[model samples]
Target chain A: DTAVSQTPKYLVTQMGNDKSIKCEQNLGHDTMYWYKQDSKKFLKIMFSYNNKELIINETVPNRFSPKSPDKAHLNLHINSLELGDSAVYFCASSADRGDGYTFGSGTRLTVV
Target chain B: AQSVSQHNHHVILSEAASLELGCNYSYGGTVNLFWYVQYPGQHLQLLLKYFSGDPLVKGIKGFEAEFIKSKFSFNLRKPSVQWSDTAEYFCAVSPWANNLFFGTGTRLTVIP
Candidate 1:
């Protein structure tokens, strides 16, 4: 069974469009996170949630938002996508922040 | 300043060769460290972790890492690397319970 899974493995959208990526985990973890991997393979934290409670924002722009409906699911919503928003977004979950994480395959978002 | 630093951006090794990847972090107070690996077109996987107790920790695929608190380093190493071991390696730190910080990543190319 997949520990962590993400939907819409590939997404191509135009600028000024809105998009959302969904993530789920079956590991019974309490914490979920959204991360962006750039073209240079630099991973940056976008948001973090624990038990459906927002924990950290990571100084990301207001255009990007994350919502957690439950402890097992965390979704990312991007508004007015820009060219710079084109990157691979990864979803991950862990029992807690101090524990190692299990990551999803990632969603490749392309904005033109 | 980067929270985590992976100085070796790329490393190449032949089959059966020993491997080592450097990782350092700039953080104070108690922290949890981890090493994650991502194969081509795959999601990231936890290779090892350090959360206290023994400074040396072992994970899947015969990978191991040592945490040196004095130097703020957690270096991943494998005595013999197979071609299938080629992947991107990332070092991460959780300084607090709210978020995780990842390194820039190191691409390891293992030759047959």
Candidate 2:
């Protein structure tokens, strides 16, 4: 069984549009995170949620938002998508932040 | 804020060759370390982790890492690498139960 899974493995949108990516995990994990991988393969944290509460918000723009309706689901919504926002976004979950994480198959976003 | 540095951006090797990837972190107080691997078109998977045990930790796919507290380093090593082992590796650290800070990834290409 897939421990962590993401929906819409690929997305194509135009500038000024809005998009959302869904993520789920069955590992009974308490924490979920969103990370972005740029063209240079730099993986950086964008947001983190624990038990459906926002905990970490990096220096990301206000256009990006993350919502966790429950412990098992964490979704990312991007508004006013720009060309620079085009990148592969990965969703991950862990029992806790101190433990290792299980990442979902990334969603490749293309903004034109 | 915690940060991780991966010294090698890209590496290439032949099958059966030994491999080593360097990882360094900047954090004070207690910290947890981890290594994650992502194969082509696949999600990231945990390779190894270090959390206040023996400094050396082993993970799946014949990968191992040693945590040196003095130098604040967790280096991944493989005695022999196969073509299938080629992937992008990430180093991460979390000082506590909040968020994980990841390093710039190292892309490995093991040519057969």
Candidate 3:
């Protein structure tokens, strides 16, 4: 069984468009996170939610918002997608803040 | 702010060769360290983790890492690598919270 899973493995959209990526975890983890991997393979944390509560918000632009309706789901919505927004976004979950995370197969977002 | 650094951007090796990837973090207090691998077209998966205890941690696929607190380093080592081992390896650290700070990954290409 897949512990962490993300929907729409690939997303291609034009500039000025909006898109959303859905993620879910079945590991009974309390924390979920969104990470962006740039073209150079530099992965950085964008947001983190613990039990549906916002915990860590990195220096990401407001155009990107993460919503966690419940402990099992954390979704990412990007508004006014730009060319620079084209990168792989990964969703991850962990039992707690200090535990190792289980990552979902990333969603490759391409903005034209 | 805590940060993780991976020195090698890309590494090339032949089958049966030994491998070592360097990872360093800047944190003084208690921390959790992890190594994750993403094979071609696959999701990220944890290889090994070091929370506390015997600094030397063994992981799947004949991989191991030693956490040296004095130097703030967690280096991954494999005595022998196969062509199937070619993948991108990432080093991450969690210092205070659940959010993990990841290093710019190291891509390993093992030629058979």
Candidate 4:
């Protein structure tokens, strides 16, 4: 079974449209995260939730919001996507603060 | 702010070549280090991690990493690499939080 799974493996949208990416993890982890990987392959953490509570929120713009309904799911919604929003969004989960995360196959978001 | 730095952005080698990728972090406190690999069209998978106890940690697929506290570095190494080892490797560090600070990945091309 895939420990971490993300929906919409690829997404292409217009500049003013909004989109959402869903993520789920069956690892029973307590912490879930959303990461953005740019064309240069630089991965940056955007948000993190611990047991459905927001714990880490980086300097990401308000256009991007992460919602975790429970410990198993974390979803990202982007409002009025722009050209700069074109990047791979990855979902990850970890059992604890000291454990390495299990990452899902990234969702490639391209804003035209 | 905590940051992770990967020295090598791209590397190419023939089969059976020894491999080493340098990773450095800018955090003085206790931290967790990890090396994650992303194969072509695949999700990111944990290669190795260092939390505490023995500084050297072994991981899947013949991968290993050493944590040097004095240098604030955790470098991944493999004695012999195969063609299947071609992937993008990411170094990440977490200091007292669930969020990871990732470095720009290193793309490895192992020629057959």
Candidate 5:
């Protein structure tokens, strides 16, 4: 079974458009996270949710928001996307803090 | 701020060549180290991880990593690589939770 999965493998949109990426995990993990991988392939954490509670919110713009309706699903929403928002977004899950991180197939966002 | 560092940005090797990728982190507290691999058109998968005890850890697909506490280094190695092993490798460090700080990934290509 696929442990973690994300929808919309590739996304191409106008600079000012809005978009959303959905992620789901069957691993029954409590903690889910969102990461952004830039052109340089540097991965940075954006947000983390544990059991429907927001645990970590990094130094990211307010344009990016994450929502977790439950423990098994986490989604990312971007509003008024800019050219700089073009990058790969990855969704990951873990049973607990720093334990067995599993990443989903990344969503490549292209703002043209 | 906690950060992970990967020395090699790109690596090219012929088939049957040994492989090594270096990773370092800047953190004084206990840490969990991980090596994740992303194959072409696939999600990032766990290659190996070191949480505690026994610094040397072996992962699937003939991959292994050794954690050096004093140097804060976790280097990955594979005895012989095949053409199919061509992928991007990322090194990550987490100090206290599942939220990770990743280094810029290393894109490795093995020529058959």
Candidate 6:
């Protein structure tokens, strides 16, 4: 079984539009995260949820929001998408603070 | 002000050549270190991680990393690299948080 999975592997939308990316993990981990990979391939942590509770929130724009319905599902919603939002979004999960880090395939978003 | 640093932005090596990637973090308290590889069109895979005990940690695909507390560094090493090993390597550091702080990453190109 796939440990972590993401929906819409590729997404292309125009500016000012809104989109959502769904993520699910079956690793039975308590913590889930959303990370962004820029063109330079630099990974940046966006948000983290522990047992459906918001634990880590980085200095991201207000347009981006993360929702965790449960420990196994975490979704990202972006409003007013801009060209700068064109990047690969990755979903990851860990057993704890830094144990058993597993990542999803990623969803590529292109805002034109 | 916690950050991870990967000095080698890009590296090129031939098949069967030894490989080493430098990773450093600037954090005061105890931290966990990790090495992750992202292959072409694939998700991030954990290479190795260092939480405690045995500074030397071995991971999958014959990859290993050593954590040096004094230097606040966790460097990854491999005796011999193959062409399939070409990927982007990222070093992450977590300090009592639910998320990970990733480095800029190093692109490794192993020529066959």
lDDT of 3 by residue, A4-110 (tens): 99989999999999999999999999999999998888898999999788989989999999999999999999999999999999999887757778899999999
Q: Provide the TM-score of chain B versus the true chain B for each model in turn.
A: 0.97, 0.96, 0.97, 0.96, 0.96, 0.97
**Candidates, DockQ:** 0.74, 0.76, 0.80, 0.78, 0.77, 0.77
Give a tens-digit lDDT track for model 4, residues A3-36.
9999999999999999999999998899999999
- In candidate 1, the residue pairs with backbone N, CA or C atoms under 3 Å apart (3 or more residues apart, or in different chains) clash, namely none
Q: What share of the true interface contacts does candidate 4 keep?
A: 0.85
lDDT of 1 by residue, A8-62 (tens): 9999999999999999999998899999999999999888898788888888999
What is the lDDT of every predicted structure here? Answer: 0.91, 0.91, 0.93, 0.91, 0.91, 0.93
- CAPRI quality band, candidate 1: medium
Candidate 3: tens digits of C-alpha lDDT, residues B1-112:
6679999999999999999999999978999999999998888899999889999999999999999989999999999999999999999998866868899999999999
Off by over 4 Å in 6: none
Q: What TM-score does candidate 3 get on C-alpha atoms?
A: 0.97
**Of 1 and 5, which scores higher on DockQ?**
5
- At residue B76, give the lDDT of candidate 5: 97
Report lDDT (Cα) of residue A14, candidate 5.
96
Native contact fraction per model: 0.83, 0.88, 0.85, 0.85, 0.88, 0.80
Error of 5 at A16 (Å): 1.4
TM-scores for all predictions: 0.95, 0.95, 0.97, 0.95, 0.95, 0.97
Q: Give the per-residue Cα lDDT of candidate 4 at B39.
A: 89
Candidate 1 residues B6-70, lDDT tens each? 99999999999999999999999899998988899888888888889999998889999999989
Clashes of each: 0, 0, 0, 0, 2, 0
Q: Which regions of candidate 2 are displaced past 4 Å? A: none
Q: Can you list the residue pairs that collide in candidate 5?
A: A98-B97, A98-B98
Residue A14 Cα positional deviation in candidate 6, in Å, after optimal superposition: 0.8
Error of 2 at B13 (Å): 1.1
Residue lDDT tens for model 5, B1-112: 6678899999999999999999999988998888999887677889989988899999989999999989989999999999999999999888887677888999999999
